[model samples]
Target: MPEVKRKYVTPGELVGKGRYNRTSNVYQIEDKFYSTRVGMAEVINDSLRVIPLTGPYIPREDDLVVGKIIDHSAFAWEVDINSCFSSFLLAQSVFGRDYSPARDSLTKKFAIGDLVTAKILAFDRTRDPLLSVSGPGLGRINQGEIVSISPTKVPRVIGKKGAMIKTIENYSKCRLTVGQNGLVMISGNPEGIILAKSALDLINHEAHTADLTQKVQDLLSGSNNGEKE
Candidate 1:
């Protein structure tokens, strides 16, 4: 995907000239498209549109997301996706039509304050994003330290599979969970989690390095020996 730089649209500025409502992205301006509100401009091929910096997260289909369970019922759980509206995961949506597991089990199907990883199945543009938990590798989180950072750095954290993630895992001997929106959860023994979290943070701060391998190795060794913070 080509990168789009975010800019600002001045008040009363007509960046989009389209006659219809274009996508919310600030980069594209067409006929009937004009600034609906004052906010950041998503630069699109020499044009700009407006969108508020603080807005509801509108989930697109297949978008991997991190959500918090705020409400629960015997049949479903409602998640606050850090968006304008909350989402819901029906029991069937999580376990599937035929998959069966005792609800009373301590597997943490979901409970208030529990964080979960899931795929956005659909966005009811009319409502909150619809998320699903039935897909492979989708389920409750186990053992991890949740760290926070700027959402823009997600792509850097998850370099090509995971070549970046793999490096962290190998060095820290821990598993890391990086939410696309910049919510990271690192899990392992206390020492391992700390090492993994710090290493990942290093990667974020120093992504410009062309030779990352040696630096990663050195960091791992230092972390293991408790050489420095």
Candidate 2:
């Protein structure tokens, strides 16, 4: 396995000089790659990218997002995924191909203000994102406390190989589903949920700091008086 290198970088900083199979959030200057934003730069074997530390959520294909149903047209429901654009979940995605507006009422399935965990099916500069909730763990979010953080800090919340999230879950005894949009849905006892949220807040605030994983572990291990649910 090729070794990976990661470091915080500012815009215009030199990232590396080498041929890479994939590179993003960076511009190539001949064989050299330069950072395009203030964020974490990662060089993984043949791949390279900068994960921005602060930015609006940009819709990407296959992104798991937690969104709220804000409005609905005859054919699709508009979802606010905490991005510059509102995404649309088509009726055909939820209902069958032969769906009828008269027979299939959109509100019957998901009403306005309903929170949904969905995937981005398609997106481009020309149109708003298209979404789908027709898979395992996708659909209306029935219950759970939602906690939001900066979208860029999502990777930190998840931790290396999911170690941070697993640590929070193990210590707080909460089930957390994190959306790339920086939304997290936590379900467990009220006390556990409170504890998990605190951990998430810590991660969001100190994502750029060193030894973050250890800090999160320490926070989770400490006493947490349950907040009022």
Give per-candidate clash totals: 13, 0
Q: Write the per-residue lDDT of candidate 2 for residues 112-204, one digit (tens) a residue.
A: 999999999999999999999989999999888999999999989998899999999999999999999999999899999998998999998
Model 1, span 1-229: residue lDDT tens: 6557655565555655544333564333335444454566565564445654333445567877777888877667888666566788777776667644564432356768888888887776676677787766566776577886555456567878678778778877887777665677777889988877777777666554557655666787784465653
Would you estimate the TM-scores of all the predictions? 0.63, 0.88
**Runs of candidate 2 exceeding 4 Å displacement:** 1-7, 44-46, 223-229
Window of ten residues with lowest summed lDDT in model 2: 220-229
Global local distance difference test of model 1: 0.66
Task: Give the whole-model CA lDDT for all candidates, comma-separated.
Answer: 0.66, 0.92
Candidate with best TM-score: 2
Cα misplacement distance, residue 203 of candidate 2 (Å): 0.9
Q: How close is candidate 1 to the true structure, as a TM-score?
A: 0.63
